[model samples]
Target: MKVVIVDDAPRVRDRVKALLHADAPYAEVVGEAGEAQAAIRLIRDMRPDVVILDLQLVGASGIKVLRAVKLAPHAPRVIMLTNLTDLEYQITCLEAGAEYFLDKSFGFERLADILRDLARKSGPDSEERAVL
Candidate 1:
């Protein structure tokens, strides 16, 4: 599975990358971005299978990035990770087409499992499409 991570913090990106490498080795992290416009461009150019996005960014908000990604051609699956724990933010992100919305503090393990499942389903030998 091809993946892209978008976060304002370099450490968050690094941690997520490390998790992916350790738990989902088959998932190739194609690109990463710290802000919205660059993230949009990277997602468009890379067409990764999934995007792990932070809800905040350096410039434009992550929700804007999510909206842009949803509009892109062959839109990739989105997994939103945010420090914000507001129910409204979660609802809004989901309404905007995020496949999953998770709190950054508690979501890494779930993210790893999701990535592993995505990688498995996307593998050449797999014939089933992941339902979520």
Candidate 2:
């Protein structure tokens, strides 16, 4: 399962990558970006199966990247991870086509689990599950 990590904080990106590696070995970190434009470009070029996107990016909002990803052909499943835990923000992300919206404070493990489930569903033994 190819995955992309997009976060403005280098530490956060590294932590997420490490967590994914430690918990979801089947998930591969294919690409990463810290800003909206670069993240959008990477997503378009890499065509990863999943993208761990930060809701807050460097000098830009992650929603821009999300919108671009959603507009692309064969969009990947996006999980919005943000420090901002406002209900409205979560709803906004969901409405914008994010498969999952998680608060950064406690969503790391849950994100890993989601990735694992996605990997299992995409595996040869499982039935074909269409993922966008």
For every model shown, what is its TM-score relative to the native structure?
0.88, 0.88
lDDT digits (tens) for residues 1-132 of candidate 2: 899999999999999999988988889999999988889989999999989998889767888888888887677888888888687777777777787788788888787778877666653223222212
TM-score of 2: 0.88
lDDT of 2: 0.82
Q: In candidate 1, how many Å is residue 7 off?
A: 0.1
Lowest lDDT block of 10, candidate 1: 123-132
**Candidate 1, lDDT over the whole model:** 0.83
Cα misplacement distance, residue 83 of candidate 1 (Å): 0.4
